[model samples]
Structures are given as structure tokens and as C-alpha cells.
Target: MRVTRSLTIKQMAMVSTVTLIIVSLFILLQLFHFVQQRRLDYAQQMESVALTIRQPLSEAVLKADIPLVERLLATLKLSGVIARADIVLPDNIHALHNEFILEKPVPALVSHLFELPVSIRIPLYSPERAMRGPLALLVLQADSARIYQFIRVTVATMLIAYLLLALMLTVAISWCINRLVIRPVRHLALALKTLAPEDLIAHQLPLLVGHRDDELGQLIMAYNHNQQTLGSIYNEMYCKASGFALPSLPNEALFLALIEQHSKSVENAAPLAVIVLRVETLQETHTLVTDDQRNILLITLVNRIRDCIDASCVLAQINHSDFALLITRDSHIFRTMRLARKMTRKLTQPVTLGQFQLHPETSMGISLHEKETPHAKELLNRASSAMMSAHYHGKNQINVFRTGNGDG
Candidate 1:
């Protein structure tokens, strides 16, 4: 819920910013065109009014009818379009103006911004049928006070309208994004709180509702897949790390699986052998050596057994004093005997036992996975039995399990 709130706020901010920008641009453009067109219409209307009265006004001025001239100008002013009307004599003295001011005057800024052409000027003609140039200059200026009022109102209206529009759009879009996108992600985050590696086999992560065919759905699927793979991944790492005697090998749990897989393969079914080596002198040297020396001797024995074989075999540490290896390639009783002797010879070498050099006595055992020894467990049992047999025979020895071996 908190994440949903945070995401909504961020999305709202972005939407509001974009809406404000677009609305501002649109308002400015419309206002610009409206002002230009209104001013043009105002100028045209004023000029037409002046043109309609041109003839009679000129005749009255020629006749020296000052009252008539005043009446014409007053009528023109009362039309409410012309702001001022003036008549310039030859010496340029007499001019008339509409001194009428409105109760609600346009603001000064609006007055300045919408200032029309100073005044439209027209020349008077003579009384002859043909035009003669001589009378007075007629001047008229348009009163845009109403147009200015409309402009002000239009600007304010647009501001209010766009502000409401932007607010509504921001709210709607933020809610949708939070519901569709953020909510699912929030669900995923909550689900991940209880998810772990060891719990994969026991628990299943809950999937998102109403989003089974989208990206979030794919993400949930991938998450469940990750949980599944983690079980095997952690298992593999544990197998590698579980080898205490030799750090690079697996313990019995993984080694048993390895042996089973090897025996199941058709190419590797040519009767493999499980060879185990036991440190016979370990119990006898228990009190004679410290824990550090005993561990060093065991580690050294495992390393020597590794040095005796190559990559064709699978080596693993079964327990404290027992190490197992699988002879997968070129495995027969004769070659197994030779490999066993080699392991026995290598493991019985002198080791540094804290200022004392002592030879570790080791016994090697071998059991082949034939018709009678089919299962991996049975093979390991016979190999262990042979190891016990060699342990009782001599200091360093090699023994192979026969058909009736390990029964005692």
C-alpha cells in the first residue's frame, strides 16, 4: 500500500506537468488568434461606419451647419462603436470627441494591449458630381472596451477549464497506473517476503489475480521458476560444500545419486566399481595425535588418493575416515585390483604430525556393479565390507568383494 501511494504520487506529478504544458500552449495560441481577429473586425467596422456618413457630414460642414455636424458626430458616437470622431478644418482647429466613459472601464493594461490604430482618416469631396478634394478630414477610432472585456473573460474561462481538465486527467491516470501496474508489483513484493530457498518444496507462492496474461503474469511465472531452480541450485552448492575431508567433492548424499545416475546410463553400464579407502591407523593414533594432526593426516590421505586417479573416476568423501571413488572407465576386476593397489600405496605415505613424521596405514576395497551388485547402495555396502576385510588383513592392503563377500 505504501509503494502504491508513492508510485501514484510520482505518476500524478508527471501527468500534471505534461497536462499543464499542453494546456498552456493551447490557451496561448487561441488567445493570440482571437485577439488578432477581434482587433481586425473592430477596425473594419469603424471604417465602414465612417464611410457611411462621409457624404452628409461633408455637406453639413460645407454649409456651415455646426449643429448638424455635431448631431452627426453625436449619432456616430451613440452607435457605441466609434470611440472618437473629429473634423479637421483647413487650418486644423475644430475636432469632436465622445467624452462618454463607461461605469466599468477596461483595465489600463488591456487598454494598452488592445490599442487600435490611432484613428481612421477620410478626405471630404466637393458638392459637384465630380470629386473635388477640398473640405475637411474625418477621423474615427473604434471603442474596443467590450472586446477587451470579452478577452479578459475568455482568458479566465480557459484557465479554469484547463485547470479542471488537467486535474481530472491526472487523477484518472494516476489511479489507473496504481491499480494496474503498482498494485501487482506490490503484491509480488509481499509474496516475496515469505519465499525462500529451503521452503520451495514445502510452499508455493501465490499468483496475482486478474493479471494472468500480461507482463506481471510472466514475472510471476518467472519468479516461481526461480524458486524451483533455487532448490536444485542450493542443493548443488551444498553438495560441493559438504565435502569436509576434500573440499572439491560431494558428500555421500550427492555421491549416491551420482552413482545411481552412472549405473543407469547405458554407455556407463559396463560394470563400474565403487572403491573405498579407510584409514586403519586413525583409531590407534587417536590419543597419540592431536585433532589437528589427525585432520591433516586424513586430508593428506584424500589428496594422495586423488593424485592416484584421474578424471575418469568420481571421487567423494563418505564420512570422517571413509572416502569413496567410482571407477567408470576401463573397469574390470584386474584393472580395479591395480587401481586399488595404487591407492593403497599412495595413501600409506609419511605425513607431518606436529614435529613427528608418521606413516598413515590405509586399506582399500573394491566392489563391481555386476548382475548381483545392481543397486548403488549394495555396491557401496560390498565395498565397505571389503574395506573391513582389508583392515583386518595387514598394515596396507587391497581387497575385492567376491559373490559371497560382505555376507559375514
Candidate 2:
């Protein structure tokens, strides 16, 4: 199986982000529950301590015993559960130990603002019915430092776990997705790169994926069928021709096919110009030369035409005496005219053929197709007519055929 390496990092990042969010929410919920539970437990412990010392605290306040009251308060503070303790008498007298007094009021205020202290006020009463009224009030404040520290530790532990879990999940999820989805797609793409009509017919292409009745399997089967059909059509068109040889340029069949294809497509609606170059003295030269010499002359003329025009222009040998050039409207009228004049001058120059030198007279006829035409045959006919008109005008002449023109 092909291993897909791309998109792994991106997929991992996406999965990690989602996992982190979920884990963070879960940890936050647990932290909130823990804080509330701690606060409730602290409140219960303070309430139980207040209840146990209620009678003693009430008697110390009734007797006006300062030392005894101080000792009772000291015991509550020493328990470590209470940060501060205060005694309030019925006469509106409030007393507290100096040891519990905050040295820096700012830190105490800040602590109170961040972590609320558990404050419990217990009312004391006498044993007699007539003394049912409260003797004193026991006020207890629980130290919140331990609770806040626990919360900090829990938060740090949760964050560490979150990081570890995210990393593990990213790796595991990326591996699974790469193996199941990305690997198959990559393999299919690699196989498609090697798929060609020729290779299909020869059975030379390799199957990168295993056979299955999935979408990918169906796609591969369809592609193979299409390749076979195209290969058969190509063989029928070019292979069945007489002598089974490739069509040479100026082959009317190939030229017509190109024109027909262009006509069917709107994007290729730009004007197409066909230029016919006729050698007036070719018939005379044919009788004076052998077949090899004729071939040499044709080759020389073809080369000269090629030198005059850009590579984009198509050059074709129409017959023994005529050659055809197909150019686009973008080639400009002036450029085409200059090229035609240049071809006439070059072909007329003296060329050494065996022991004799011959000067051939050539004429060019151009016909532009500005509007849609039924077929390429019509364009060829018009170009040929223009050439005949140039012949009438005399040797080395160039004529452009226009609609309603005498030549057209």
C-alpha cells in the first residue's frame, strides 16, 4: 500500500485542537466541582468546631474572664482550620487575639478577593430559660490558602495531561487517516499518471490498487475501457490509410480535418488565411530533371518557405507544382505580405541543380476566411482561384482574394 505523507500535519493539528478544547472543558468542570466540594467540607469542619466549644465560650463571656476567653479563642486559632476568631458580647463588645491580626492588610484583602474565606458565626446561650438570650457570638474565618493551592495543583496536572493526550491523539489519528484515505487516493493518482492508450493496449501499465467493487475500482475499469476505445479509433484512422504511412504536410485529408475541428470550436473563430505558392516553371523543369532532382527541388523550396514564415504557420506541399500555407489572423496582413514577397524573391534566385542552374518563377495567392465556412475544401478552392488570378497578373505577382473580388 502507498504511504501518504501529505496532509498528515494539517490533519493532526485539526484533531489536536478539537481534542484540547474537549479536554479543557472537562477539566474545568471537574475543577469547579472540586472547589465547591472543598468549600462545603471546610464549612462543615468550622461548624463542628464551633458547636464543641459553644458552652465553654458562653461561660467565659458570662463571667467576664479575660484570660479564660483568650485561652478559648487561642484553642480555636491553634486548630489551624480557622484563620481568625472573634468574640462578640451582648453589650456590643468585640474582642479578637493579636496573633490573628494581619500585618499587611493588602495581601489579606487580595486573598479574600481571589478566594473567599468560609465565615461561620455561632450564637451562644445560657443554660437557664430566663438567660435564653445569646451571651456571645463566636465568629470563625477558615484559611483559604490550602484550598487555593489545591486548585492550582489540580490545574497544573490537568494541563500536563492535556498536552500528553493531544500529542498521542494527533499521532494516532494522523496514522489512521493516512492509511485508510490518503494512501488509496495517492496510489490511484500514481496509477493514472502511467495510464496511456498505447500502454493499455500493450498491457504494460501496472495496477497500483487491488481489485474491489468500490468507487475507485469502478473508475479504473471505466478508464481502461475508454483507453481501449481511443486506441482502436486511432489505429483505424492512421493505420488503415493506403500503405499504412503517416500523412505528410499538405495532405488534404489532414488539413481538412484540422479546419473542420477548428470550425466546430468557437474559441478558434479567429480568421484563418490560406496562402498558395505556385511554381509556374515546375512543369518545364520536371521534363528536364529526374525524380531525385525533382525531390531535391521540392525540398529546397519547402526549406525556403519555412525560413520566410514563423514556426506557427503550417506549410504543406499541395502537389508537384503548388504548396499551401495556413496562418492565423494574428499574423497581421503586412507580415504575411512581406513573407510572400520574400518567398518569391528566394525561390527565383538561381539554384544549382546538378550541372545546370535554374531560376524558377513563383506566384502567391492569399485568401482570408473572416466568416465561418462549411469545410476546408471551400477555402482551398478560393486560394487556388486566387493563384490563377496571380498567374493572369504575370510572373512573381501576389494577390489576396476578398469576397466579391473578381478572383473570388
109-226: candidate 1 lDDT, tens digit per residue: 7667656433577887767746456588887766666677668888999999989998998889888988999877767677666577666553546677888898888877877787
Cα error, candidate 2, residue 131 (Å): 5.6
* Residue 174, candidate 2: alpha-carbon lDDT: 81
Model 1 accuracy (lDDT, Cα): 0.77
Taking every candidate in turn, the Cα RMSD to the unseen true structure, in Å, is 14.2, 17.9
lDDT of 2 at 25: 93
| Per-residue C-alpha lDDT of model 2 across residues 105-147, encoded as one tens digit per residue | 3356536644667678899887564586787788888776666
Number of the top-ranking candidate, with TM-score as the measure: 1
Q: Using Cα atoms with residue i matched to residue i, what is each candidate's TM-score against the true structure? A: 0.53, 0.47
- Taking the candidates one at a time, how many backbone clashes does each contain? 0, 0
Candidate 2 stretches with Cα past 4 Å from truth are: 1-5, 89-93, 97-115, 129-133, 192-408
